[model samples]
Target: MKAAFAPTLEGWYERHRRDLPWRHTRDPYRIWLSEVILQQTRVAQGRPYYERFVEAYPTVTDLALADERELLRLWQGLGYYSRARNLHQTARYITEQLNAEFPATFDGLLSLKGIGVYTAAAVASFAFGERVPVVDGNVYRVLARVFGITEDITTTGAKKTFAKLASELIQPASDPATYNQAIMEFGAIQCTPVSPDCLLCPLQQSCNAYQTGRQQRLPVKAKKEPVRNRYFNYLVLRQNGKLVMRERTARDIWQNLYDFWLVETDEPITALTDLNLPDELAKLVQQGRLTGNPVPLTQLLSHQRIRGQFFLVDLPDTVSMPLPTGFGQYSMDEINQLPKPVLVTTYLNEWLG
Candidate 1:
């Protein structure tokens, strides 16, 4: 079964592979870009972003030279801003330190910033034609079900088990890249997490999960931690037509993105005074009247759910008011240019429009 695995998967890929732009090239920079953009993103959703990035910064040198703010702006709406930041940092590292050349080996690719084992194997196998298997979520599901690996995938021992099996499976493959892509593609389209197409699956005969009817239970992933609920009260100070916003600098979610003055609470509040703002903020709130009611918004992240209540405080345009430290007033044009969390963007569109 191990000897024929790669050939069967490669055959399946030759017939079922989707025509994606990244598959057409072996350039490491483009391949790396696609991998970074597609992290935590589906292909259908990430394809346009990939095209935009390739069009905007065609090479490692171009990416390294891009302004951080502008890059973040381009990467807005793609959750996990750290991926974009890491991509930029790695690009610069490659351009300045490595003469704009990607490391050709799996070990070398793993040494790059934010390049994990999965990413390293993907770049090495796909871009450099190295005989390394890419073991991401899709691979995990495929290997677990076909081999009936019931070990919890989140544990270190399970990871080693899967990695060892993956390495062994790729040894017989004539083309490592095609075999890797085929298994991942098969997992995604045929053996999906829910309602897998087992009826017409090519691997049905060999798939232990299908034969045992344990397809949904083989890749034993542990339950995730409870989602932490946070309440964010945004004080949107506006004068004339400009609004006040600041870049989040804390070592927390939405870092490097722009948002209004935020006051987080353990519980939801109905009124501005519930915030018990500092004297300076209270004075600012006093100077301005609330505009209508507090607009509510919510965003769900990987492990946190944020409920935001935006309180619009319209100060008199006749006299300029001092904003809180690190906060700056910007026109609608400027606000439109800044990178912001999806929650902030939703508020701007729904409230301002």
Candidate 2:
């Protein structure tokens, strides 16, 4: 199986691989940048960000020296703010500690922030020819189905198992990078998560899932937590062209990002009229702080669905906000410059743009 694996897959890769920007490079930094951007992101969606980042910070040292706010701005709308933060930290560590060179060995690479085993393997194999296997989502699906392994792919144990299996296949290959790239591309294009092109697959005859008619069931996952619903009411305040914006410091979704005055509810409110605004906000309004109404909006995250209502308030010139420290007013220009979550950015563009 290992003897035939490389030639069979690498042949397919040579003919069918997509002409992505990162694929053309042997540079580890460029490959690392693309890998980080591609995690949990579609190729089409992440390609632009890869291009932007490459253009913005041509070198690891350049990224290391950038301000956090500026880095967050570049990473805006790329949902996982933590990845961006980790990327910045890793760049700094590499530039300052390692003389701007990515660690040559997989284990050394893993010591860097945000570079997991999979990422380490990918970079090490592709850039340094380290003869290690790369197991990402695509690889997991392909291997589980091809071999019809039933171990739930979601668990940590499954990861080591799959990585070991993948390594066995790659170790015998003439070039590990070619085989690694082939398998990943094969999984992405052939053994897809949904509605795979089984008929056209070259490995269909040998595929255990196809033989047993269990393609859909082979790559099983442990049941995740139930999808949770959350209600968020944002107070979009404006007084003499100043808008209320707060840096979200809480250890929640969009942490360290900017948002508006928020009120979270346990249950969804069908209408703004049903919601009882906080007493402090109500008292402030009565004391000539502002007058407002709600604008409905909602966004879906992986584990949670958020239904949001924006209460736009216009304050009188004489009143001042009793907002907490770190909650400040911003002009339209300043507001546009701050790093905000995608949901908040959408609202601000519609209401204040």
The local distance difference test score of model 2 is: 0.86
Model 2 TM: 0.64
Best by TM-score: 1
Scored by lDDT, the top model is 1
TM-score of each: 0.65, 0.64
lDDT (tens digit, per residue) of candidate 2 on 1-353 = 65776788888899999999999999999999999998888889999999999999988899999898998899898889999999999999999999998899999998889999889989999889999889999999999988888999999899889988987888778888988999999988988988889999888888899999999886999779777999998767788889888899888999888888787898866544455667766766565533444777788988888888887778788887787567899998998789988888888887667
CA lDDT, every model vs. true structure: 0.91, 0.86
Segments in model 1 whose C-alpha atoms lie over 4 Å from true places: 227-353
Error of 1 at 255 (Å): 43
**Candidate 2 regions with alpha-carbon error over 4 angstroms:** 227-353
lDDT tens digits, residue span 169-193, model 1: 9889898998899999998888898
Error of 2 at 103 (Å): 1.2
Note the clash tally of each candidate: 0, 0
